[model samples]
Target chain A: MRKLREMLDKADINQFRFWTQIFFFALFIYGGWWALNWSERLPVFACAFVQDRCGSCYLLGLQHQMTAPVSRMFSLAGLGILTGFLTFLIWFVLLNKAWCGYACPLGTLQDWITKIRSGIGVRRSQYSETGFKRLKRIKYALLILLILIPLAIGNTIFGSGLSHEFEIPFCMICPGRTVLPIFNADFSQLMIDFSTSTKMILTALGMAVTGGFFVGAFVKKRFFCLFCPMSALQYLLSRLSVLRLVKDGGKCTRCNNCVQVCDVGIRQIAENMEKGDILQDDCMLCLKCVAACPENDCLQLKFLNIPVFRSTDTGFFCRMEKKERGI
Target chain B: MASEEQSRMAQSIRMHLAMETEDVLGRISMDEAPQAMGYFYRKLRQFFQQPEGLGHFDKPGIGTFCAQVPLELIEAAGARPVRLCMAAGIWDQAGGELLPAKSCSVVKAMAGMAASQLFFSGVCAVVAPTTCDGKKKCADLIETMGIAVHRLEMPPSKLSRAARNYWRESVETFMAQLQGWTKQKITRKSLHTAIHRRLMATEQFRRLCRLQTKGVLRAVDYFLVTQTGFFDDVEAWTLALSDLCAELEARVAEGRGIEKQNRPRMLLTGSPVLFPNIKVPLWIEQAGGPIVTDELCSATDMFHDAPAYDETCLHDMVSALCDRYLSPCVCACLSPNPDRIRKMISLCRQARVDGVVYQTFSGCLSYAMERNAVAKALADEKLPLLYIETDAGFEDQGQLSTRIDAFIESVQAKRRNF
Candidate 1:
């Protein structure tokens, strides 16, 4: 067991993450060819629009559950909603935000775009601190609207409402709805729907977001993750997750290596000396900070408060040397 | 090529250094001292006994005044980095004639060495980080002595984004200057290799620190091992340290540690305690207190923080190097540095030391100003602290020893009451 841990501590985190991302990308995107059906409520961006997908994103199920009739909210339908949430919670607690980092199909696509940009030697862009502060709130706002709009469409709220087109408000604008289906050789979701004005507007918005996502993620890493409503929802229950990103403040040197490598520009990882639990709302639990930390046991990925992977000088040098050798 | 007067002066300085080195060696020598320590002891003796023949690097030497200048950059440029900070009464006296009497002894000794041209003869150029006023002046002093000097400007504070970017740019500028001086273009591969070499040495240093905290290695031995790294080849120093750690580990396994269980473990902070000037540490040990660990920039802090870069790109690696050298530093020269106090308290807690001994060279105003803050922080933690103000001179050794004994006795009483 100790030998396993030593190997893990010195493992090349980027290689591990790259292969893990590819494995999950294959499992979620192409699992149907093997007749594999995992679940309908995996808390990642496994789009329901993909007909052959093994599982659907929990947000889609959540929106459908919220659009139930008001009278059914207290009945078996309500129990179904509760059970579905518990299932999502169980899946979430197993990996926390790693679902977004390693399993999200849309996230994988964005990483590929980033690789292309880096290959071309184009400098990646990061948001200014003020801009990041302002934009980080958009995810939460989208989360609120996704829940409330679905509820309003199902039942009259503050008067009258009748528009089923707004059923899954976030999914209509989410770029994943249009982008992920391309993997299944389905380009049908790329067009703006002309059936009705409501469908026309929502589908047009989706098309625009998809275009923006392509360009934004090319120049900026993890661009779509900035406004990902699923990320916002996951953070609400982040405290209950068994998996955690823990910081030993006493051991941290505040060298800013973690901040420099963070995809989302989370500076608090290096600055916050008082906090033990370092998982911020924007953190995807990618363990990049742990990989970048040079101090021994300074940053750790702990499950049940036991360190599974912790930062060490030897681990840091090994990873850098591997990168140097192009391994 | 040397004048008769200059040769006589060099001879006098070497004699004084030999006497001081032998005195320190005599005090630290014991029957049970680890055999691995002979390497460090010989290195220290060679440094003083043959100052002219020290630092035999295959590559040209680049002198660095402070720890802020990244050694990896120099190594990447195919030059060896020789840290030139020193502390000795003879050199301080020589430099006192050239500078104001109120300058710190460290800067004074460095200026004295530069003036004599004994140490800087082999160094092709010097990179001086403007960490404090005295060092900024010392850079001028070294330049006046006809040695090439590059001033690496350090930011006043490291907490702000502007400060971090400024430091990165400064480091880049220094890298360019070093490349020009060494006439070697620093490629990504070379930089990565340099970083790896230093990381290996840093790992070994940390292991030695762990052994010291375990009471298997003595404090003076630890200081000597680290101080020898100032001029020794990094790989060689690392190998010797590895041997020392191995021997110490065996001793620990056999339960033959050097420190007595009843001795009060102390944490040393405030100012860099260089070699041949270890009076405070020696007095602490003689007063029944063992320095298990320290927060000195000249020793443990120099190698404690290694650069951790994510990408292999040169831009990302250089940025990581810049932050590694700047952000973690708890130097008293940096303003608005609450991290220093926090670090001192953290070290005390980690080492489980009975007390803290804060030593400030008499003319080191920066560390002197931080004494009250350190005392207040230690007081809040309910740990005893002793603040000593002296210089490279030996006039205050008796007084400092008396104060250290009283502080240790008080700590023992406190431990007993608890």
Candidate 2:
């Protein structure tokens, strides 16, 4: 038991996160085309939950297929689609936005871009408090727009005889539709869909969004994660998550280490005084703050009241020494 | 031989201090004067002497600064643990090559000692704790100079579960390193024995502190007793202190203290005051106010809290070590260092201290930055705290004397009216 405890202490949590990201990134990007025989119609958000080109697009398509035209009520097939959504929610609750931290292929891609940027000695951009707050609202707005546009299209609330191009409204301009296929050695989404003026405009928007995500992620840590519609949805439902981040505020010395190491730059983890559960909206449940906190039991990662990992002074020092040496 | 050197230094300092004492107490050695302070004074002087050559030891000598490093671990590894703390008094030219003028005085003195390899040559390894940026960078510099330097990272937050775990791991790592250096296995038994010895030593030291608080023990005697632990082996030092405590308790029972009655009582707080660097405490006593207690790392701070070790398991012992070290530490490196201020306020109430003499050496930013916060906290309780910023220089003696004298006089006057 002592030997096991020693091994656990020596284990590097960030190393575990790194390999987990790599495993999930490969699975999501290559799984469908390779072995599982999963189709594009398989209503799962794990594939890539990006706005405009995400699993929500497939969900909306399934809703249109199952429900009677102009009727908002769910058919038997629509309940199947709802079950898919429930499955996604269950998975989300299990990890609780750790998908953003450990499984998001796009987030992992952005991290790779950040590493390249750092390798070239390009400093990452930091957002001021007000700037970060203002920009933080974009993801929620995007989520709202994603759900509303698809709902209107499915119900034919707009003019009748609309083109099939309007079927998945968010998917029409999602950057992932153009970008994520590159990982599978597919480049067909790179072509401009000049079939209609609307298709051409959507393709152009996709290209632009892809370019923006690339550059922004290069200059900022997890840049696209800041406005990820999927992240916003996960955060909204995270209250029911069994996975939790706990802070012993009395033990915390307000050292600002949690803030410093936080990829999202959330200060409340350290500054919180009226504390019970301290998961911020921007928190990815990355547990970087847990790894970085020098105080004993100041920050804890709990899975249904069982401690998985905790911040420790020795671990903090070891990580910091590595950071100082630029390891 | 070390004792002889120490007595010589002690004699010189007493003679120098006697020049000032004449104006206050009228021609008497500190021994004959009050509480038999001269004996403890001699002990402190001897401890600081650091013999002509580093004393012969069967095992490696592990040198460290700051109160964070646990000496018992070194002892358990069969290595001699030596405290390398010093003032600018003995710093040689070697220190100037590596450090800028703005560097902390303690680091400069340490660098000088390390570079000369004259006094600190016996140290086979240096266990440097990253308490402040000065010490952290100094450790790096020293490591590059080919000394086997182990950097101990103390988590800035004291009260956290993470900090405690990390400290225990750090102690374990250091223990392993010490065993490797000394080529001896540090058995669980030896580690527990070392911890038990420390607990015993600290208990005796606490007794002296309580006696000092009650005015039966002089400030100088307390300083002497505490600083001796830095040099002497725990067993001998504890026995000596145990004997001293018994003698002091007897005096207390007999209703005998220093000749001067109702003198102003002040609590000393700040940087570690070493031997030969006893000018600050001397001035405080000479000003007609005995320092009833101190919160400095080198003095009462080291003894006030004993590590409550569980003898059952080694891990529990290590946990106790972390808690005890991290808990009492009021070092400026920690954010929201309310414990130091809180301890001071509580000590003031218990010791019936009239004022506080807060000292900070120049360039010791940790204590300097904390001085205002401590003063403000004391102010809220309507306690008078005097901030004295100086170095190991004797040039500031007159200035220190005037401020302390006025502060003591004010306390006395206030008491007379109250």
Chain A TM-score values for every predicted structure, listed in order: 0.98, 0.87
Best by TM-score: 1
Across B229-343, the per-residue lDDT of candidate 1 in tens digits comes to: 9888888998998999999899888878653766788999988888878888878877877788899998877988777765566787787788889998889999898888877
Across B1-418, the per-residue lDDT of candidate 2 in tens digits comes to 9767745644554344334323322222356334444455455444344332454645567888788888878888888787777663545234656798777667776776666554455778899887988888888888887898987778887766567567768877877788789898876577767766776676667767777776766565566566667766778777777777787788777778755558888888988786446678878887888888888888866665544321124554565566566655778788757777766776786677888999887778989999888888888878898988876646788888899899999989998988
Model 1, residue A113: what's the lDDT? 92
**Candidate 1 ranges with C-alpha deviation above 4 Å:** A1-13, A65-86, A115-123, A148-164, A192-201, A294-297, A312-327, B1-11, B54-56, B413-418
How much is B312 displaced in model 1, in angstroms?
0.8
Off by over 4 Å in 2: A1-327, B1-28, B33-50, B92-98, B258-261
Interface RMSD values for all candidates: 2.1, 15.3
Per model, the share of native interface contacts recovered reads 0.57, 0.00
Question: What DockQ does each listed candidate score?
Answer: 0.54, 0.01
Clashing pairs in 2: A52-A170, A52-A171, A295-B163, A296-B160, A296-B161, A296-B162, A296-B163, A297-B161, A297-B162, A314-B166
